[model samples]
Target: MNDWTSGYVAEIGYTYDFFHAMTPTRMGLAALSKGVQHPFGRETFSYCELGCGQGFTANVIAAANPHIDVHAMDFNPAHIAEARALAEQGGVQNVHFYERSFADFAGSPGLPSEFDVIALHGILSWVSRDNQRLVYDFIAKHLKPGGVVYASFNTQPGWAAAMPMRRILTDHAERGTGPLEKRIDDAIAFAETLRKSGADFFANNPDQVTRLTKMRAMPRNYLAHEFFNKDWTPFHFADVAADMGQAKLDYLGAANLLDQMDELCMSKAQLEILDNECDQVRRESLRDVMLNEQFRADLFVKGGVPFTERGAVGAWFATPFALARRYSTGPVKMTWRGLEVDMAGLDYDPVLQKLSEGPATVRDLLAQGLFGAMQWADITRMMKYLVGAGFIVPCLPLDGIAERSEGCRQFNLAVCKQSEETQKLSFLASPVTGGGVAVDRMEQLFLLARSEGHETPESWALFAWQILAPQGQRLEQDGKVLETAEENIAVLQVRAQSFAARRVRILEQLGISLQPIATAQEASVASSAAA
Candidate 1:
C-alpha cells in the first residue's frame, strides 16, 4: 500500500484568508514602483495559482477582475470541492478549480496553454524538493513571455533558531498513533514537559520558550500544516533566485510595497552596503540578512521589460489613488516589525487633506498646487510610504469598472450570506482597487442587513442579534463576554453606527452598493403596478 498525501497534511485544512498581494493589480503596482514594466495592461489575461489551498484568493481575484480568467489547483479534493461550491454559490464566472498535483497540472490538457501570472503563497518551503522542481518545470513550460510569477517561502537565517523545535515536533508526531490532531497536541505537550523539566535547549534559548507560549495560542490546524509537515526547508534568497532563474524568471521585487522602502527596514550603513552591490541576487541576499527576514513574498518576471527612469516616474505620478479608510485629519502612525513609527513630522497632512475630498493622481494634486514647496522626490516618497502603510491604495482603471463592480457585488453578497455560518471569510471583493478589503464578520452581517432593507443602524443591530442569539453567541468587550441579549444588541448597535459613519463611505467609493437587489416577484409586482 502507498500513502497518497506525499507527507503533507490532509486531515486538516488551510485558513480561508484572502491575500491581497497575490492579486494582479497589487503586483503590477509593486513592479511599477520598482521601475519595472508588467503585463497587466493587456486587455485580457490568464492567471493560475499552484497549490491553491481552498482557493479563497483566486475566487476573490476573479470576482474583482471579471476581465481576467483564473485557474487554481490543489491536491486535496475537499479543498477543491469547497472552492467550487463557493464559486457556484456566488454566481462567479471565469474561474476554474482543479484537484491536481504539481506534476499532474504541468501535463494537464484542459488548462489554458499559457498564463500571464502564476502565483503561489507559502508553498515552496513546505513541499518536498521533487514537488518544488515540478512547480519550476510548470512555470518554464507554460508561463507566457513578459509574465509574472509570485512565490513566497520561509527564509533561512530567521528560522535557524526555530528549526530544532520544528524537527522535534515532527519526529514526535510521526511516532505517535491515532488521529493526527491528537498526535500534534501530544507532541506539543511533550515539548512543554521538556521545557518544564529544565531542558538545556529551552534554558539556553529563552526566545524559543516565548515562541512556544505564542504557539500554544495559535490554531491547531495552522500548526499541523505549518510545522508538522515532513518536508519543511527554509532557503537563502540567492538559492531561490537561482531556482527561479532555471525557469528564465528574474527577480522583480517584493510583492509587499512596504518591503521596497529600505529606510523603513534598514540602517544607513546597511543601505550603503546594499546600494554598492551590483548584482540583484547578491543585494537581495544581503537585504534579507540585514532585516533577518523570516518569510518573503517575492515577484519574478519572465523576460521583464525595464522602464526608463522618466517613464517610470511619469507613469507612477499619473496613476490615480484613493483613500482606503475614513477621511481623518491627524498624524498617521504605522507599526512595522514590532516598532511603531510616528509620521507626525512628515508633510503628509496636506496630501491627506486633499485626498479627503476624493481620489486623485499626483499630477492632479500638483495641478491643484497641493504640493506647494515640496519637491517631486519628497512627494513620491510620501506617496510610497502612505500606500505601503495601507492608508491609501491605487484605483483600478475605469475601462472595466462597471463589469468589475457587478461581479464583486455578487461575490460579496455570497460572502455576507456565508458569514452567518462561518467567520473565516473576513474579506470582500472591491472593484475600485481590484483587490480584497478586510471586512470582519460583524461588519459583514451589518452589510447583509442593510442589503435586506434594514435602513437604520438600530435595525441592523437587531437583525444581527437575531442571528447570533440562535447560535448562543454574544459580543465581547475588553475580554469579557456580554451574555445578555440587550447587552449584545447595544454593543452591536454601537458598532453598526461606526460602520455606517466610516466604512459605508469607503465602500461606496469602491463601487460597492448598499441598496437591496429586488427579487423577481417584487420586480414583477412593481411592473404590474406601473402598467
Candidate 2:
C-alpha cells in the first residue's frame, strides 16, 4: 500500500450500510432536547460527512430531504466509486461524493465555506495524530457559527480492558504478507490460542476472552480497520472535549439518544460513583468508569446560543417523528450500563398510542388532550427515552418530503431491488422517518414478493425460503438454528403473516404513504386503515 494510509487497511472496502443514528434530523433532535442551537430545523442547509465509507447515509439523506446539500468523502477511492455509482443508480442528484484525504479537504478552496453540520463517525480514534489535527482544523474553518459536529469514537475505561489485545492483533497482522482477511483471521486465532495457553497476559487481561470471542463474529473488513489501524487511541471525555475546544466548539450533548436519559442509563448505585467529582467534565469522566462505555457518539457545537426552556418546549413540540414500528412501547424495561431501568410508572402509553394513530409532533399529542396531566419536562423525558430506544424516529417536514417525492420513491425502489440480492444493505432510507429503517434479508424478500403480486403471507414465506434454502442457511428460532427446509419454512410462515400485515404496510407508509402535514385526526384515520 501507499504511504498515505500509514499502515491503515485500504485493500478491503467498508460495509455498504447506513447508520440511522448519524442522520441530521436525529442530531437536530439531540441538540433541541438540550436547548442548543441547530440548523437542521431550518428551511435549507448544507451537510458534510468525514470518512463517509460507501456514502449510504449521505445519499439517503439527500434523496429524502431535497432541501439539504449533501457532501461526503472517504479516503478510499473504491468506496467513493461505489458510493457515487449507487447515487447515480438511485437517481440522487443533490449528493456529491469525493475521494479525498483529510489534508487535501482541509486546504481545498473549492469545498463549501460553511456547513450546517459535519459528522465524523468512528474516524476520530482510528487515524494518525497529524490527521486528527487536520480534522480539527477542517471543522474550525468550515463549520458554520451555529453548526453541530457529530463525532463518534471508542472511549476509555471500557476499552482499557481490551487495549492490550488490540495492540497484539495489530502487531501480528502487520508482520504477515497474506491477504488482509487471512491476516486478521490468523491473528485472532493466535490470540485465542494465547488465551487457552493460560498466558500471564490473559490472566492480567481477563476481558480479552470475551473481547476475542465477540471480535471473531465481526466482519473482517471491520476488524481490519478497527484493530489494525496504525493509530488507535481511545480517549477520555474530557480530552476529546478539549480537542474540540481547539475548534471553538462546545460539548453539546450525546447524539446517541439513550445517553441523554440519565435515569435510564445510570443506576442510583452507579450514580454514587461520581459523588466526589463535582466538575461537569470530571463527573462525565468518572461516569465513564461507572458505565464502562467502550464507545461514544457525541455532538459538539460551534458558538451554540442557548435557548430558553420555553423555546425548547416549542421546538420539541414542533419537531415531528413517526412511531418507528420497530419496538413495542408499553412500559420501557431497558438495561443500560448494567442498570435495568423500567418506566412503567411513566405512562408513555398515551403518547405512543397517539403516534400509533399516525405521524404527529409532540404538540399534536398534547393538543389532543393526551398527556394532559404531565408537564412538558415529564413528557419530553419519556419521549426522549422512547426515541432513544428506536421506538420513535424523527421525520422531515411536509414540504421537504413533498418536494423530494420522486427522488425518494425511486431511491427506495432501487434499494429494495438491491436488498433482494444481498444483505449488505440492511437499512432503507425512510422519508417519513427522515432516517434509515432496519430491513433484514427475509423482510426484503417479502417486500420484493409483495411487489411481485405475492400478496399472501404464505407466498412471501415460500419466496424467502427459496432464497435461504439455496444457500444452505436455516431459520434461527429459540436458541438453535433449524436446518431442514420444512423447519425453516414453518417458522418463516408464522413470521410472514405478521410481516405482511404490519411490516409491509409500514414499508409502504415509510416509503411515502404518511404525509407530513396530515392532521392528527386524518392521521388517526390513516392509522386505522393501516392496522
Candidate 3:
C-alpha cells in the first residue's frame, strides 16, 4: 500500500479545540489595529482554512456569520467527515468541507477561484518543504487582491534548545514497538529516565527538563502529532517572510497582538536595537531572537493599503466594542510575559463603565469625554490592550443582526445537544461578536436545561447530573472529584448560580438565548441530507 500521509501523523485525530484568532472578526481587528483594511469590512466575504484540523473554528465562524462563505480543506478524511457532520447537525449551510492534499486542493476544480481571507494554523512548520511550496502556489493563484492571510507556525531560537531533545524522542519512538500512542509514552518515559539519571544532554539544557515536565501533562494525542511528525521545522521570521514575499504577500502584523506593543514585550535596549534596524524583516527576526519566541501567529496581506493617520483614527472611532465578560471595579489584572496591565490603575474605569451600559464606539466615548485627558494615540493603544487581553471584543456591524442571531441560535442548540454525549467542545457561536465564546460543557448543559424549561439553578444542576451520572462522570472541584450525586449537584448548583449572575447578561448581548430554534424534524432532514 502506498503511504499517502507524506510523513504526517495519521494514526490519531487532533484535539477538538477552537482557536478564536482564526475567526474573521479577530483577523479584521488585528488588521485594523495596524491601520490596514481587512477584507471583511463589507457585508460579505469568503474565508478559506488550509489544513483545518477538526474544522471547529471554520464551522463556528460560518454559523456565527451568515453572510460569509467558508471553505475548509484538510488532508485527513476522518477530519473532513467529522466537520461535515457537525455542520449538518447545526444546519450550517454556508461552509464547504474538502479532504484533499495540498497539491490536489490546488488543482481541484469547481472550488472557489479566489478567497478574501486564508488561514493556516499549526501547518507550515509541520509539513514538508514541497507541501509548503504547494500551499504558496495555491495562495499565489487563488487569493484575491488585497486579501489577508493568517499563518501560525513554530518559530526558531526558542525551539533551538529543544530541537535535539525532539530528535531523540522521534528516534526513540521510531525504534519502539506497539501503537503510536504507546511509542510516544515510551519515548517520553525514556526522556524522563535520562533526566533522572543526570544525562549530559539534560544537564546541559535545563529548558528540556522543564519542557519534559510540561509534556507529561499534555494529552498523548497532542504529543503524537506535534512531535512524531517527520517533517517539523521551525522557521525564522525573515525566512518565512521571504517565502510569503514570493506570493506577493507583505507582512502586515501579528495576530498575537501583544508583539506590536514594544513596551509590553521589549526592554529599552532591545527597543533601541529594533528601532535602529531599517529592514522590517530583519528587525522582526532579531526581535524574535531577542524574545526567544517559540511560536508565532502572523498576518500578511496581498496588495495591502495602509490608512493615513487621520483615516486610522476615523476607523478606530467608528468601530464599536463590548465587554467580553463580567468585570468588577477592582484591579482588572491581565499579564503578558511578566508585563502587568492594571486597567483600573490606567483609568480605564470610565471606558469600561460606558461599555457596560451598552456597546460604545470610541467616537461615542470620546464625545462623552470618557477617556479623560488621554491623547488619540494613547486611547488607541489602550483599546488595543483591552481587545488583545480579551477584556473587550469588537462587535459585528448591526446590519442583518437578526439573521445572524437566528443562524447562531440553531447552531448553538445543536452544540448544546452534543454536550449530552461529549464535552470536548467548549465554545458557542456568538453572532454579535461574529466568533465563538468560551462556554464550558457544564454551562452548555445549563443552557440546554433552561431551553428544556428547567426553571431554576437547582433544576439545571439536577438535569446535568442526570445526563452525566449514567456515563460514570462526576464534577471536579479544585482538582478533587466529587463522588456522590449530592456532592456533584451541590457543586453544580453553585456554579449554575454564578453563571446566572455573571454570564447570562453577556450571553444575551452576544445574541444567545436558551431556546431551541430548530425542530426535531428539521434536524432529521438535515441529518438525512448530510448522510
Candidate 3 on 1-531: residue-level lDDT in tens? 127899998888988888988878778878988889878777899899999989999999999998899999999999999999999999999999999999899666658999999999999999999999999999998899999999999999989999988998999998999988999989999989888987998889988899999998898878977888989999988889999999999999998666788777678999999999989889889888888888999999999998898888887878888899887676566778766755444678888887876677788999999989987778878888888888888888778877888889888988889999898889999888899999988999988877776656777789999999999998788899999999999998888777777776677767776464444234323323322
List, residue by residue over 403-472, the lDDT tens digit for candidate 2. Answer: 5666766676677777555777777677776677777777777766655556467877898888777776
lDDT of 1 by residue, 1-531 (tens): 026678889988988989878977788889988788887766789999998998999999898888888999999899999999999987788899989988787666679989999999999999999999999999999999899999999997888888988888889989999888889889889899989999999999898999888888888888988898878989999999999999999999999988988877677999999999999999988888887888999999999999998888787777778888875777778898777765544578777777776778888888888777887767777777888888888877778876787788888899899999889899899888888899999989987887776667788789999999999888899999999998999999899888777777676666665343334234223323322
TM-score of each: 0.94, 0.91, 0.95
TM-score preference between candidates 1 and 3, better one: 3
lDDT of 3 at 20: 80
Q: Could you report the Cα RMSD, in angstroms, for every candidate shown?
A: 4.4, 3.7, 5.2
Candidate 3 error regions (>4 Å)? 343-345, 516-531
**Alpha-carbon lDDT of model 2:** 0.79
Q: In model 2, what is the error at residue 167, expressed in angstroms?
A: 1.5
Residue clash pairs of candidate 2: none
